[model samples]
Target: MPVQRGYRQACGVARGLDIVGERWSLLVVRELLLGPKRFTDLQQALPGASPNALSDRLRELADAGVLRRRQLPPPGNTRVYELTTWGHDLEPIVVALGTWALAAPPTPEQIFVSADSAMLTIRTYYVPTPDQPAQTLQIDLRDHGPAGTFTAHLTSSGAAVAHEPPEQPDAVLVTTTEALLAAFGDDDVPGLVAADAVITGDADVVRRLLSSVHVPPATDPR
Candidate 1:
């Protein structure tokens, strides 16, 4: 691929923009945030982009040193793309952007998030309360089609989220995408449970986990 044009300016922000300013570049970064992905996986995660566009963006990001292509060893020897350490540093930026964007009401057109993206959104929106005791919970979230597992560790000071399941989670919650989204939309745990969402282990811990993340109302601009 031929080289793309730069901003031709000396500012740091401009330099940063020159590298990731192209459309779909950051979204590519978002797809790789959880881990490596094959080209087809990326295509599935970002269905809006054409294959050629995805390929070009990957090439651009690789050339910019934001991503690298590697081949898996032995059994699964397929080539996949992953972010470099520097690229991984973009997580905070992406999370912050998501938090900011959530304030806006979703339009009818927007739909679907990759399993990882949904987990990451939970991590991004989670806020620990001062009075709440520290706790850990595991979530086995299922969509109507696919499923994923995650763990959230919360404390009075802060909270952390991991893609893996906790060995001895204080609680485990299982729900579909629609139910989970509804929970996040209104902090409605009973509603979800009534709708067939399952809860195992300590119910209080699950409550704490759900309460930690605060999603603004649909009418709230801020």
Candidate 2:
């Protein structure tokens, strides 16, 4: 369906597309997933969209009962957009699409996460470390849709990937695909702090691992 789809279509697909079929409409859902956001925050997340388009889409979505405008605490009179109970229903559809795409040929995470300009690398790995030499870390996440693939090399210099359980990764961090990009790309682990991405096998060793596997400063936005 093209961008102009209206609510009058007969088929369910047509009717459904009527809500999120616009160029940047579904992405509006994406920004909201992170949390309720102000209009400016949405604009920053959606760089290509115009303020007018965003306002129109937001208005339409609210009218359709998908999103709702909420007010923040007193003294801070800012308007934020949040998904209604009905809007939360779309999560499964998004996740199913992710699973469906995984069935196709696996190329790279970049292809799946191409929506955002930020190039990210997400990977799941089993790494061996000194503290917990037998542990393994399996990570999965992408900030963008379709998800991306990346290699989490053992950052222990010449130590190489080991087979021991606890001595390996110490902890496994699971998060959305962009966990790495935010940690390593934007160099902002604080962003995921709210989600607590670390999965600990050996708490002590995982602490060290966190410092070791970090992306270089070059990609650090903060």
Candidate 3:
């Protein structure tokens, strides 16, 4: 059969690339990975891209079967974009790309990353033992001791709600957004602090949380 213009030649890697090959195409997919989002949510996720372009890319993604629009049920229903089973197939590809980028990082200014991690940096709230009222909050490298890739997981009722190296996060707090995310699965928190990572959030919780979270030797600078 003849290959379609945008369709993957063998429905293999190339085809996968074809579907999400544009500048922000993969980014868009990444945002959707968190959960369903409205049009504005995606726009906010990508700071640089314009609305027209974002809309176009989303349309293309849907056409390629990478995602589909969903509607909420009777309670607090809202229109949102979500990945299909086919869309989920792209996860491995994205993760591989992340691993590759971490292996050899670029300079600081040229670095780029999604705001989700940025929020993870600033917005997340945590308590050290779930018994204390979040004392000893840390933000930026100066506040923390080392510089390296650090991953965090959320817990509730003494059970893990989320953790990294594989699972998605409400947000991923780190030093360098672009390179760090690329290096996340292989993180090292102490080294990240030693390297002067730009960190923000509940310092005490972050310190305690690290013990529970696991990062591969590479991502973690320490």
Candidate 4:
């Protein structure tokens, strides 16, 4: 589909931009990277976006074949937007973009970070190590507006996160986004546990997992 006010360039990057260069276009795709989300979920994730603006972006993305809306079956009937097969292909691109952004300046204090974005942090900064044994972890993030449960798989090569709980995880970390970020950025598990964070399983798994995250420093160096 043709985008409005297109760059009208012949290059591949320009062409791709023409489709997703709008303000919140790529962010919309980012929210759906893990799985489908209801309109309310998107709103919670992107508080800066006006309802009308978000609607317009969603429509445009649907037209561009990046996402599709579907209704859930039965008792939990609700509409949700999910990335199409072609849309899911944007995951690596989004990850690369996020990784690229790590070199940029630190964000201002109290900036909002959606749960999906928090999960993406895991994917973006994942470091594989032979000493880091494979394990399944259940992550429960609360008080982040529409709390999220995720299952993370740490492998020899990489880590994978899904928006679902595991039947039997090797460890479970329950914490708020702030504490989780603190742990991720500083690997401060004991501090987190002393605060609002809770751990039900192997603490070493949680420690190793948090230590494995290589996020940019929260404070500016300059």
Candidate 5:
């Protein structure tokens, strides 16, 4: 497939957009932020994108030095895509954009948020409280329907998500997407527990973590 034409502008923003402004390009970057993923995995994550469109976007990103395709070694010799060092630099930009977009009024229709996206939100919006001690809190966030597990490491510095579980997690919180959304919106611990969200190990750690999330104030719908 032929690559799309650039904006032909000298501005830095325009040049940056020329590389990643294409449809589904940034979404591809978002998916690879956590780790590498096979093409099929990318397809699954981005269900709205057609196969051809996805292929083109990946090609464009790779050409622009945003991502690279490599073959996994030995046991898993399948080809996977991962963000380059420069590509990883886009994390803060994407997080900021997501945070800003959160201020927009909600739509009538439900929005589907992937597990990675949810974890990214937690990482981005987390704020450390002066009262809370600076300790590492590890929590396992599980997506029941998709059956994927993500480990969140919370510290005074910030929060980070990993594909594998922490060797020694301070606590574990297992909940579905719906329950997570509710808890994130209201910081309702009891409500989540009542709804079957399981919390094991030190409950205080989970409490502090939840309390630290900086939810944006409600915006006027009008």
Candidate 6:
């Protein structure tokens, strides 16, 4: 499909925008950052995007070589959308864009974050220290439809989160995506427990992980 719109500029940023500046385009990229997702999965994660609009964005992205569609084998013969190598390069840009937004007005209290967005937020604010111990935390978002589990590995250098579970986790936290995101801000283990979060391992590890999240002060809009 021919690119629907063009800025007709030689600038790289302008060229980039020509490819992904359309509505819902980058959001599609965000959903696939961790792994491939079927059309239904993207629909669930981005409830606001209309099916037609989403399809258009997907087609445009694929045309731009940002993502590709593939079919799985065996009992799971399903088509899923995943980011291509060039598309995966957008991770830092997406992460940095999110970090930049945190300085603006806080997100409305009523806005619910998808599981992937919540995990990306953790990746955005997580701070690594030279003395911090290496450990893995299994996060189970119980309320998320199709309930998903992710593993977070913390090290002195960085923290990495994946969609798969860890073989041996130092701590396991069971909570809703909303509650988990809230914990990142307050480091409130008791509150999470009160909210019905199940802690199967050392809660301190959870606390330390939560405490290490640093959301910079929001910028005054004056």
Per-residue accuracy of model 1 over 132-210 as CA lDDT, tens digit each: 7778887776762333677778788776777678888888888776567667634567887997889988887766666
lDDT of 5 by residue, 166-187 (tens): 7778788887765776676455
Which 10-residue window of candidate 6 scores lowest in summed lDDT?
Answer: 103-112
lDDT, candidate 4, 1-222, per-residue tens: 436788878998888988888889999999999999999989988899999999999998998899999999989799999999999998899888876666666557646778888888887787877866689998988866344788889987888999989999999988888778767845678898997789998988888788888886534435
Quote the lDDT for 39 in model 3: 86
Instruction: Report the alpha-carbon TM-score of model 4 versus the true structure.
Output: 0.89
Residue 91 in model 1: lDDT: 90
Q: lDDT for every model?
A: 0.78, 0.53, 0.53, 0.85, 0.76, 0.84
TM-scores of all predicted structures: 0.81, 0.49, 0.55, 0.89, 0.87, 0.92
Which sequence of candidate numbers ranks them by TM-score, best first?
A: 6, 4, 5, 1, 3, 2
Distance from true position, residue 66, model 4, in Å? 0.7
Candidate 6 Cα misplacement greater than 4 A, ranges: 1-3, 107-110
Overall local distance difference test of candidate 3: 0.53
| Per-model root-mean-square deviation over C-alphas | 3.1, 13.0, 9.4, 2.3, 2.6, 1.9
Whole-structure CA lDDT of model 4 = 0.85
Candidate 2 TM-score, C-alpha based: 0.49
Scored by TM-score, the top model is 6
Q: What lDDT tens digits, residue by residue, belong to model 6 across residues 1-222?
A: 224678888999888889889888888999899899999989988889999999989988998899999999979999999999999999999888877776777666737678888777777778886887898999998877553688888888877888889999999998898777767756789998998899988787798778887767679556
Tens-digit lDDT string for candidate 2 (2-121): 246477768988788987787777777755643477897677667678999999899888888878999998897999999888887875665455445544554454333432222211
Assess candidate 6 and give its TM-score to the true structure.
0.92
Q: Give candidate 5's TM-score.
A: 0.87
Q: Write the per-residue lDDT of candidate 3 for residues 124-169, one digit (tens) a residue.
A: 2222245533223222222222322223344442322211232333
Root-mean-square deviation of Cα positions for candidate 2 versus the true structure, in angstroms: 13.0
Candidate 4 stretches with Cα past 4 Å from truth are 1-3, 185-187, 216-222
